[model samples]
Target: MNNKNINRETIIKFNPSQLVNLPVFLLGMILIPGLCLLDDLIKLYLPSGFIPEEIELYIRNLPVYLALLYAIYLGYQILKISCIRYEISPEEFRYYSGILSRKHEFIENYRVKDFSINRPLIYRLFGLGNLTIYTSDKTTPVFKMEAISNPQDIYKTLRGLVEQNRRAKHVFEVD
Candidate 1:
C-alpha cells in the first residue's frame, strides 16, 4: 500500500449527521411538556361549573398523555442516532451500533469493489448524503453510510485506499 497518501494514525470517526427535522423534534420535546403544564394552570383559573368534572379531568390530562408519548418517541430517536457511529481507518471501514451493548463490523479496503455517493436534494440542503460501498465481502456485500457529511470526499478517500490495498495484494481477476 502507498504509505505517503495514507495516514495510519489519523482515523476519521463521526456520528450520524443531524437530520433536517432535528429542530422540529427538539422543539416538540420542549413544547409538549410546556403545553401540558399550561393546560393545568388554565384549569385552576376556570370556574368549577365551567364543564362537567369528568370531561374537564380528561381534557386537562390529555396533554400530559400526549407529552409522555412524544417524550418516548423522541428518546428512542436520540438513542438510536447517538449509538450509531462510523470510522474510516487506512485499511478498514468500521461501523459501530447498538444501545446498551455494542456491535462492531469491519470491512477490509482490499475487498471493496466500488463505491458511490448519493446527494439527494434534501440531503444536500442539510450537507449530508448517503454513501454506498459495493464489496466482495459475502457477509456484507453492500455497506452503507447514511446521513453523513461530505460523502464525496469520503468516497474518494475510501476508493483510493481500496485501490492501494488491491494493488498491494496483487489481486487480479480474469473475468
Candidate 2:
C-alpha cells in the first residue's frame, strides 16, 4: 500500500453547462420572441384604443411567467458558484452541489474509463467546450463534467488520469 497523499482534497470549480437550465432558457427564447410576434397580432385584436380587455389580460399574464423563468435562470447562474465543487479523495472522486438540499456523488478512481468532449454551436463559436466521463462499470453515464470551457485540455487531463489509474492497477495485478 502506498500513501499517495491524495486524500480529502477539494477542487472548487464551476462550468457553463451548469448554466444550461434548458427549460428556463427555452422558455425565455420562445416566449420573448413569441410575444414580439404576437405583438402585432395582439394589437390587431386589441380594440385599437386603451388596450383591449383580453390583450391587457394576456400581457399582464406574460410578466409573471417571464419573471418566473428569468428568476430560475438567475438562480441557476448565481447558485453555480457556491455549489460547484468536486473533491478527489484517495478512494472517491466526488461531486457536490445544492441550492436548497445538498447533493453529492462519490465514485472510485478505478471505475472511470473514458472522457469525452462536446460543444454546442454557441459554445464552439465562443471557443468553449464541454467534458463528459464514461465509467468502467457502465452503470453511471458520461456526465457533462466541466461545462463550457476549453474542452481539449480537460479531456486530456481526465483521460490521462483514468489511463494512469488503469495502468497502475494492471501493474499491480502482474506483480
Candidate 3:
C-alpha cells in the first residue's frame, strides 16, 4: 500500500567487472612468457638435423602457436564476462547475458529466500565482491552476481526490498 513500494524503477543495474577474469589473465601472463621461453630453449637444445626440416619448424613454432591460442581464449573470457548484466527493482531481479544469442531471466522479489556476499582477497583489494541469491524459483534456484563493486550495499537494498515485497504479497516461507 506504500506509494514508495508501488514504483517499479530499477534500484541498481550493473555489469560484472572485467576484473572477473583476473585469475585467468594472470595465469595467461605467466604461461605466455613461459611458452615463448620454451620455444627458444627447443631451438637451442635440439640438434639441427635431429628431425626433418618441416617437423623441426613445426616443433619450434608450437609454443608460439599455443601462446596465440591462449591469447584468443583470454579475449573470449573477457568478452563473455563483460556481456553479462544484472538489474534489481522493487518487484523483480533480472539477469541478461549472452554473446551472440541473448537470454533474459527474472525472479520475483518475493521468491528470494536468502543472500550471501563473498569477498575474496583479490576482490577485496579492488572493492569488489560476489553476491549470491538463493531463490524459490525452480529455473534459477541459485544466482550469482560476480565481481561487482560495493556488494554489501546492494545486498542490503535487495534484502530490504525482498522483505517488503514478501510482506506486501503475504508470502511466508514455511521452512
TM-score of 2: 0.59
Rank order (by TM-score, best first)? 3, 1, 2
Q: Top model by lDDT, which number? A: 3
* Candidate 3 accuracy as lDDT: 0.88
Which whole-number lDDT from 0 to 100 does residue 59 have in model 1? 73
For model 1, residues 1-175, the per-residue Cα lDDT tens digits are: 1123446642577677658347658789688778867887867775677789998777777777777777787787788787898877778888899988899998988888878788878789988999999888889999888888888877877777777777888875334
User: How do all models score by TM-score?
Assistant: 0.72, 0.59, 0.88
Candidate 1 structure, TM-score to reference: 0.72
- The TM-score leader among the candidates is 3
Q: Give the Cα lDDT of each candidate.
A: 0.78, 0.60, 0.88
Worst 10-residue stretch by lDDT in candidate 1? 1-10
Q: What C-alpha lDDT, on a 0 to 100 scale, does residue 73 get in candidate 2?
A: 67
On TM-score, the stronger of 1 and 2 is: 1
Worst 10 residues of 2 by lDDT: 1-10
- Give the candidate order by descending lDDT: 3, 1, 2
Pairs with backbone N, CA or C atoms under 3 Å apart (clashes), candidate 3: none
Candidate 1, 147: how far from true, in Å? Answer: 1.4
Model 3, 126-174: lDDT tens per residue?
Answer: 9999999999999999999888989998899899999999999999897
